[model samples]
Target: MGRWVCRLGPALLLALTAVLAIRPDWNEQLFLLGHQSARLLPAVFWRLVSVFGDWKTVIALLFPLAWQQPQRLPALLAGTALAILLALLLKGGFAVPRPPLVLPVGTVQLLDALPGNGSFPSGHAMASALLATAWSAHPKVGRWGAGSLAMVAGLVALSRLAIGVHWPLDVLAGALVGWGVMRLALRHAAPQGWPEEVAQRLLALLSAVLLLAVVFTAVKDWPRHHEEYWLRLVIGTGVALGGLLRFRR
Candidate 1:
């Protein structure tokens, strides 16, 4: 079963990517559903779920799981690193304007700013997918984890549209990238190791410190349009650093 999971992981990801990439219109409709769902769900509830759906949360959740299998830490780190690199590359390359910038649209009480670029791939979606993929190795937790991730991914993707930040295509592409990276990690996950209790404790501490720094930076730079960008960077960095620390003795 594990072997099959490793092999099928990439195939499933590729298939999902193709589906999302080719069916742009479908993504639009999906985005709309997400928007409506967001409206129906209470703001507090949505916000809570959104955290789980975010990439940083996913990585944090995976720390203990991956810590048990120190070998797997590398794959998770690689996946996270690639996701960050890809998100930056795509953001810079496309420079797609948000919906408000390109088309006049109603606001959705966004938690972040509208990036000054093209929205080809949803960074949030990609991060969520990558986290989901990394957790897919455990059959017991995989289903619930993936389902939770899907819910979060959908919300984040829709949040983008609700806030007029990204087109449906962009979210779809981001999801694809995230899923692909996760599969790569699963395929190469390492073997299990010692208890790693101390390692986990250290990682948790580091993650907390990094998170505080990010929050501090965001607060200090309040009202700036780049707050969301920096926030995500801080979160991504924390997750990556935490994963790396988990591997240390």
Candidate 2:
């Protein structure tokens, strides 16, 4: 399983690069499909699906895995960090405008009211893929977990299109960024036995908090409001506290 994931990583990177180099019209076509699909599907359904790729939700899902298997923590951290860095670099370098900015007004329906940013290499897609790749690398998770995460990541990529914020190339590039980073980090996810128990306790507590946040978000209908940033901030604080606890000891 590990060997295969490692090999597939480079292939994905190359494929993304090739597609970008070709500069085909696939991006516009795929975006049109996403727009049409959203029109066909219930708005509520896609709203929920969008949350799965959100930063808070991704961290909520990732923290538990890291807590349960300490070895994965390093790779998860590194993969996510690398994903963010790469995503930012690509976004800035390309400076590509989002669909809403480039396409006809009212053609794109954005789920959120937030301001837009660079369009190349969808950040949400990259982050979700990073989490999925790191989680899949753990021996306890194996291929099934990886496959499930991949599906979730794919949904995330699609959600970007559905929301009309990103191009197909952006999502593809982000996915490649995530996959390649995780593969590199997997080589260094060794566990240090002494800190395992302490880190577990801290992370587990934070995970519980995130679970409660999920319930709160659902009850309050925050997804509909597109309050992803606030949710992410809360979870991010929890994660930081957990990190401090784990490292302080």
Expressed as tens digits, the lDDT of each residue in 1-249 for candidate 1 is: 444444564466467657766886675566555655566655545444445445555666667556555556667767888888898898889786655554336533554555565577778778766776666666566555656655566666566665545667777678778877777666764435324564465566656665665566556666654324454555556665765565445
Error of 1 at 93 (Å): 1.3
Which 10 successive residues of model 1 have the least lDDT summed?
189-198
- Model 1, runs deviating above 4 Å: 1-37, 42-48, 53-55, 105-112, 142-145, 189-215, 218-249
Residue by residue across 1-249, what tens digits does model 2's lDDT show?
445545675476567657754865766877888777877776656666776666666766677577667766766766666777787788889888888888888788877653456888778877787777767767776666666777788788887788778888888888777777777777765434337665566565655566566556666765455545455555655665564465453
What global local distance difference test value does model 1 have?
0.62
Q: Estimate each model's TM-score.
A: 0.66, 0.75
- TM-score result, candidate 2: 0.75
Question: Which residue runs of candidate 2 sit more than 4 Å off their true CA positions?
Answer: 1-17, 189-194, 197-249
